[model samples]
Target chain A: MIEVKNLIKEFEGRVVLDDISANFQKGAVNMIIGKSGSGKSVFLKCLVGLIRPTSGEIRYGGRNFLAMKNREMKRLRRDMGMLFQGSALFDSKTVLENVMFPLDVFSRKNQRERRKRAEFCLERVNLLDAADLFPSEISGGMMKRVAIARAIALNPKYLFCDEPNSGLDPKTSQMIDELIQDITRDFNMTSLVVSHDMNSVMNIGDYILFLNEGIKEWEGSKEHIMDSDNDKLNDFVFASDLFKKIKEADAIITGNEANEENRKKLIQRMEEEAKDL
Target chain B: MTITGSLENIGEYALLMKRVLTPPDRMREFFREFFKEMYKLGVNSIWIVVIISFFIGAVIVMQIALNVASPLLPRFTVGAVSREIILLEFSSTIMCLILSGKVGSNVATEIGTMRITEQVDALEIMGINSANYLILPKITAFVAFMPVLVIFSMFLGLYGGYVICYLTGTPPVSTYVYGIQAFFRESFVWYSIIKSMIFGFIIASVAAYYGYSVRGGALDVGRASTDSVVINSILILMTDLVFTQLAMG
Candidate 1:
């Protein structure tokens, strides 16, 4: 479990995250969803220890992430897999080498073992054919897949992805989402993703935390989001054409029940007229 | 067991030192990035260095010829002039200028780009020392290769002078050779090598510092690259003058 407690991050006297607290459950997809500049990215950065909160504690499975020593942080980071927004693939290395890099740095495994592990991870991401290609040689979606492979090469217990579907087509975005969900389930790793894409939210967001103006306004599963009575969330949901149609359908069903008694009276009158004739 | 605040700096310093000692293999992964940088520094500036060297050699040769060819001047004056210009000033100073543009800017830009891309952060998250993985090999390679480059520059400058002298028809081959043999001292060559070594260290460190300290984005990387070369070039010229006074005194 990842728990962020009363986190406050201030930049140059301006508040980015003000007294924000949330718990991310283990072995599932936990998403931080917000509009642009709503502090989701800052929250993710804080979770990874990239940016330390001004006054807060982030506990990773009962270990204090904020107060740990450098080596301890490093040790904890070793169990973390981060997929950067740009894929951040070492542009000079091929897919195989990029995937192999973490193992080479942290593991005592020999070249052959590292290669095999890297290939396995590549296959898991369905990027085995692209093992020899460089980041530039592949498409954006492919690069993300490669990044996913590299992220899981270490068999990390925790995964962090920042905007995994940005700049990708809808189909590719769905595929990436599915991959992330499948990987989370298969590996039983705690996954925390920061994204604003609604498709991803509806598809894979097992637990969603909604932020409004640097404060977490709501937290619930995607299944209950339609029934959530929060006006701000309602405005956001109804702002879309698809959600507006769904809203119209729901209102019609509720209003039809109140008119059912009048319809029964009209039916009795019609039956009396038929008997007299 | 130390706190993150104090230990972060220590880790940064350690990574910096490690980078100065070991070049990361990821550099190969980013070879295209490196080469695009090298093309800007190495290939594009070839004409500039060549032009500067040509004029500098010609001017030095002219001044030496006028002073030494006088009937009252000693025959050894030719060798003395060649030795002084080649060993102390021309080879060391000009090469430093050339490389301040080439290697210095490269280090700054490369590391700066890495910072912008969050690649450095990625490395840190992976438990690898970003500085050691990125910086060490470059410093080692620069320190190791600079003297060789300096020697090549010295020979090229001398050849430039030969061309100038031959065109002017003022000093015969025999006179030039005799004068060079008479005045050229072994100590001068050793001093030139030592000066170049110092210059190389200064250039690499300054460039790496700017590169590593870069914040923001690609624009900042560009600024860092420019700032490093300017700062490094100034330091090189200042150190060159100081070393010359010290050596000659």
Candidate 2:
């Protein structure tokens, strides 16, 4: 489990995270969702110590990450695995080498041991045959798979993924999401994923924190999301025509009623966003 | 703002110093990386350096042979001219110019791409000091390769002079050999080698620093590469002046 307290981050005197705090649980996917520029990525970076919070305390398994010394920080980092938005694979390295890099850096494992472990991770990611291929030779989806394989090579206790499905097609995105969920469950590690993709939010979000322009707007599960009464959350989420149609269908079938004024407000918000789109 | 810039410079220097003092295993990895970089530098860059060195020698010999029409001057003066040109300037500065285009640009582009793609961040997240992992090895490789390249430059420069003298006027072989032997001191060769080593260090560090410092995305990487080349060129020239004054004097 990870506990964050009063996290505040400022870049060039502009506030990105404003006294945000939350708890992330192990054995489940903790998803942070927001529109672009809404501080979800910053929050994720802060938790992982990639970006130092201006004033906050992050407790990972009871240790204060912010106060750790350099050596301690490195030890903590060894326990971390992050998958970046761009998949961030080393271009010059083949997939096998990329997976073995962390082992090369932090472990005393011999060449055979390293190769065996790397092959195992690649197999887990369904990328066994692509081990010898360089990142440039692979597609984006394959690169993301390689990134995931490398991230899990160390069996890290904390996993952070930033926009893991950014450029992927919807079907591939769902596969990636399912893979992450399966990994979190199997490894029983604290998983924090930052994204705004509704499909991802609905699919793998065991717990979700919604943000709007740097403030935490709402937090809940996918089951609670469809009926969430938070005006802003509902507007941003159900604004999609498919979700609106679903909501309308639900109301019609179940004889559930949304007040006339609320229905009008939802339609108006969708129209406004449609105009901009 | 000036203070901020100076402080940043100090911080950069301090970081480099700290990177130098890391644990033995980490330092060894850096040297291993240096070896890899040196292999790339030597193999990839030899043709360019040799070609440029040859031209530089030929150009200098052509000018001296054409202009020094004085019968009173020793015919061996041609080798003296060649020796001075190679030992004093060409071996160090000209080779660096070629390397700045070859090795320096590659370093900038590699690290710049890493920065923009968040591979540097990946390293940092993994608790590996990216500076030690990336920049230190390049610096070490530069220190190792630059001196050898300078020696190559000197040899090529002399060969260029010999070729030019032979092709242009069929000057007596003994005179050219005598010119090379005349007024040649070990100190001059040492000075040139030292200067080249320093030039190599400056070029690698400046290029890597700019590449690592870039933010945003691909455009930032491009800008960093261009800036690294420009800044590294200027720094190499300036360091060359200081190195010559301090070492040759």
Candidate 3:
């Protein structure tokens, strides 16, 4: 489990992450969703030690991540794996070499052992045929798969993915979502994903944290987001006509339009955003 | 930028050096990278060095021989002057300035591109010291190979002079050969070799500093690469002046 308490980050007198507290459970995909410039990336970077928060307590497995010594942080980073939005595979390395990188650096395995492990990771990602191919030789979805294979090569205790579905088509996005969910369950690793894709959120979000302009506006499951009373969350989330129609159809069928008044208010807010744009 | 900002950058550069100089996390991987870098940074550069030094040496000989047109001066003066020019300055200082443009810009663009593309961040996220993993091998490989390049330049340069004397026959080949062997100081060769090694370090490290400091997109990477070459040239000249003064002043 991971815990963040009273986390605050400011840049040049502008607050980016307000005093925020949250917990991410082990073996479940915890999702952080927000509009752009809403501090989702900053919050994720802080958790990964890429950015230092202004003030906070970040505990990973009962250890104070914020206050660990350099050596300790180095040791702990081995247990963390991150998948970048751009896939960030080493352009110079072939697919198999990319997976074997962390193992070569940190594991005491022999040559055959390391190669075998990297091959296993590629096989798991169904990318064994592409082992000899460089990242540039692959498609966007295939690159993301390679990134996933490399990320899980170490069997990290925590897996963090930033916008893993940003540039892919719907079918590939769904496949990636299922893959993330399957790995989290099979490895029982604490997974934290930052995305704005409602398809992913509704399909795989076991837990969700919603940030609106750097503050936690709501936190719950996908079902809860549909009925959430927060005007900003509703306006931003259901801005798509498809999700709104689904919500309306569900209300009509279940006679659970207890928040029908809330829906009208959200429509009004969406209209206001459109006018401003 | 203000003085405070410049000082902050210097501090950051120093800290980055510390990170880069740390021991590798794994020996096998370090050696693998080291050998690859030796080939990339050192072996790949042999042809350019050979071509430039050979032609320049021929030019220096012809220029000096044409200018010493008086019977009052000895016939060997052209060869002696060419030797001094190549050994004392050209092969070491000027050649390195040329290489700074070739190799320095390369290191900067490669690393800066990696920075903007998030490859360096990936290394850091993997618990690898990106500086140590990426820059150290290049630095060591270049530093190790620079003296050999300088030696090659020295011999090739002298041979070019020999060819010029043999072909032109203005100064007799025997006279030029004697002049080449005259006043040949072992210390001058050592000095040039050592200076070239230092130049190698400056070229690699300063380029790396510029690359690692990059934060923007492709345009920023281009700026960094150009900036690295400019700074490397300036630093190489400045260090050359100091080294020459120490050795001959």
For each candidate, the DockQ is 0.39, 0.74, 0.83
lDDT of each: 0.80, 0.85, 0.91
The CA-based lDDT of model 2 is what?
0.85
| Tens-digit lDDT string for candidate 3 (A1-277) | 9999999999999999999999999999999999989999899999999899999899999999989998899898999999999999999899999999999999988889999999998888889999999999999999998999899988899999999999999999999999999999999999999999888999999999999889999999887998888999999888888888787666656655585764676667678999999
- Candidate 2 reference-contact recovery: 0.82
User: Which of the CAPRI classes, incorrect, acceptable, medium or high, describes model 3?
Assistant: high
Better of 2 and 3 by TM-score: 3
- Model 1 alpha-carbon miss at residue B90, Å: 2.0
lDDT tens per residue, model 1, A14-51: 99998988888888999888888999899899889889
In candidate 1, residue B206 scores what lDDT? Answer: 77
Question: Which one wins by lDDT: 2 or 3?
Answer: 3
Give the distance in Å from residue A181's predicted Cα in candidate 1 to where it truly belongs.
Answer: 0.8
Over 4 Å off, model 1:
A249-277, B1-59, B66-69, B163-169
RMSD of each: 7.9, 3.4, 3.5
A best-first ranking of the candidates according to their DockQ comes to 3, 2, 1
